[model samples]
Target: MSYGLFKKVHYTIPVEKINAVKLTQSLQARITGRYMAEVINVGMGDDGTDQKAFLVLYSSRNSMQNYLQMLLPEFSDILAAPAEKQPRVVWAAWLIPFSGYLVAIAAGLLTVLEFRPDFLKQTVIAAAGMTLLFLLSAVCRFFTAGVSVKEDYLILVRGYMRRSVICVSYDKIQHINTKQNFIAQKTGIQKGNLHLLASALNMTQSVPYFREEELDVIKSRMLKTSHAQ
Candidate 1:
């Protein structure tokens, strides 16, 4: 069973009340990037019994406004942005194979320079192993992956070996993260996972090998899709 865990809750500053332009300008100056936020959802809680507004953000100025409108339908009828506008890359799955290929070629070269017949065998074996690994990784990449934009649900499937499928919905999504390790960066592969509200059923649906950038795109799409009404 898979579940989501709550990591953090970020409160928003009012757009009208704050100096939106000045704040944005400052952020741009300091970070050399544009900033945007979108209001996603709103409702009252036990503390204030007041409606809350949720928003999404983008570093790009134009994209931010568009995402906001998508999240808040009552505010606008325009489509702000696709759930996934920028995709993070996952390089490892792509890298491992290529790395394997390179190593095999290197081994062959070493064999030639050293005049050792065994180098050819070693290179062939290494190349074969790497090629197989790459093939398997790429194949596994698409196996059981699933995403639900309407229900704000996402499912990740890892087949066979330690295989697990995880399912998560927005209300229960605890965390969404993007990570790239040193090796993963070489191939541009980023991995992501979801922490969900804990429960026996959900624990069974937890995902293990999620592609990070793609997952965020799914999340963005779901949140925006939910507001279509």
Candidate 2:
């Protein structure tokens, strides 16, 4: 299961100003060996105007890497940015939910001990086991989740039991939204959502507990790439 999760890598290329046909041909030529490629039309914009953007999906990470290597020189200015990982504070956000669970478990334990002395040992063991499991899961998730920005694509990496990568092209992005509650605002951590036009159903990629300033930079880069001729 872990092997399957790590096998795939998702990435994208921007073809807004470039010729899609030519770009596809170039990618195909460079991506040798066994691989599958599909071109998907992302549909019209919110204003009812035809959006010319296309999403190119590759079956494997090697194929995407080969394509990027071949295409990078031509679009260097647009794709020059390096990928960014989730900040340490992002992982700390898990403490909020963990704390809630801990509180509930403590209350339950207290109630049970007060009512029944026979169940005290069992209650204590169960609470300790649950707390350990939650902490482990939170730590694993915190280490695994991250975001990377390429020339034309924003890559979202998420995993716990199994990992998956979602690469959204700039032109295919319909909206970039950010939100922060009172606690999050105080900590300078925010949640971000990327709304995409390519999926038939409303699809969103979420980034939790990212630094607000970093998200703003990503949002700015995405906007600039989307508007590029």
Candidate 3:
């Protein structure tokens, strides 16, 4: 096929009053054979509402033309305004893992000071090595983790040593849950879990520390999308 014959069409859908499941099904039915829809979670509203946005990428010109023809009548209500792309991880994510590392290093140094002052230099070196390892691992994970939303599907990318990208369709999602500890809550960071119907496995994704409002937006969107299909 000629490059000119294929054009990419992008749509950012806003999740609000519309039935997300129905909308996704309708779109999926139409584009199944003609084009692939790449969906991405563009992030949530700063206005502090449960507003969620999605970016859909269509690679086929015919499918794009067909979708555009029906978009206004079928999806305009769910169409969302453009949103700023959220960063992959926030600064607090960089700090949380190091908190434990800090505690461990402090305890080690104190033990050496009380019992073996002559080994202080060795303790410091060991502590520094441990700190460097923890920092490296945390930074790698922070950079590697990612989540993407698509029509009828959600994609989770995670890990550093054994990286994996999992694609789960909305239909296969049995439940969506969120968790936060007292410190996590205070820091505005939370973890989300997706329960899958097929293997009875839970896929977990962590949101780096962010505004509580933004977290709510992301959680709401996931729940809505999972339930919709």
Candidate 4:
């Protein structure tokens, strides 16, 4: 890729080093049927991760076609398997929030009965309402989230209201870490995160909530893939 107004700059990027491909469409671009894509590339150096960006053809037919051509074969599998309908660990979504809320409700119920007996009914109603909201969030998350390792990519899918799919190439991952807080430890919920070759975008691919064993599967797969590569 080469571009410049006065002094032309040329970039020779390996497909493997390309970490992210983001297409942006504005109101004008939508109507004009022309869009811009950001291609983020990363490489490892003796000092640290080196990241660079390329702005693909903007508002030009040739640029759009070039981007689509690069996008299709590169992420065909991920596109074929859409994130919105991916399978999820249903219980993992509700477990943490539900546990905390249950404890608070139990305490509130006891306090109201002992000190404010007159407000016990009202407290119960409020608790029920709050529980419903938490349940609704869990349902939404269950439908939105997924974590899968396919071929050489680690795909982390999650969001509510808007869907986000994070794609991380296995070769670029610098580290893999897992965490469990106090509540998470009690509830058997864990988080797994990948430290990829650093970039200004700080794009993270992770499984935010899951069972310990589920995270283990991802770790095992990643290690095997890395070693194989």
Judged by lDDT, which candidate is best? Answer: 4
Q: What's model 3's lDDT at 70?
A: 62
Candidate 1 per-residue lDDT over residues 86-167, each given as its tens digit: 1224334546656767787777667665886656776668667866886676554444233323334444434422232233
Instruction: Report how far off residue 194 is in candidate 1 (Å).
Output: 1.9
lDDT by residue (tens digit), candidate 3, 1-229: 1122375433344433222211222234333533333222323233455433322343354554455346424332222312122244444554655677698789889999999999999989988887788777767666655555544445555554434344544554556666666665666655666554321122233333334565445556666765665
lDDT at 178, model 2: 85
Q: Once model 2 is optimally superposed onto the true structure by TM-score, how far is the C-alpha of residue 197 displaced, in angstroms?
A: 1.9
Candidate order, TM-score descending: 2, 4, 3, 1
Instruction: Return whichever of 2 and 3 wins on lDDT.
Output: 2
- Give the per-residue lDDT of model 4 (tens digit) for 124-168: 999999888887777766776666556666667666544555566
Full-model lDDT for every candidate: 0.42, 0.56, 0.47, 0.62
> Which candidate, 1 or 4, has the higher lDDT?
4
Candidate 1 TM-score over all chains jointly: 0.36
Q: What is the per-residue lDDT of model 2 for residues 59-117, given as tens digits with 9 covering 90 to 100?
A: 35455556555643433222233435567766455567777898999899989988997
Candidate 2 local Cα displacement, residue 140, angstroms: 0.7
The TM-score of candidate 3 is 0.50
lDDT of 4: 0.62
Cα shift from native, residue 85, model 2 (Å) = 2.8
Candidate number of the best TM-score: 2
RMSD of each: 18.1, 9.7, 13.6, 7.5
Q: Model 4: residues >4 Å from true position, as ranges? A: 1-18, 21-68, 71-73, 82-97, 112-122, 179-191, 199-204, 208-229
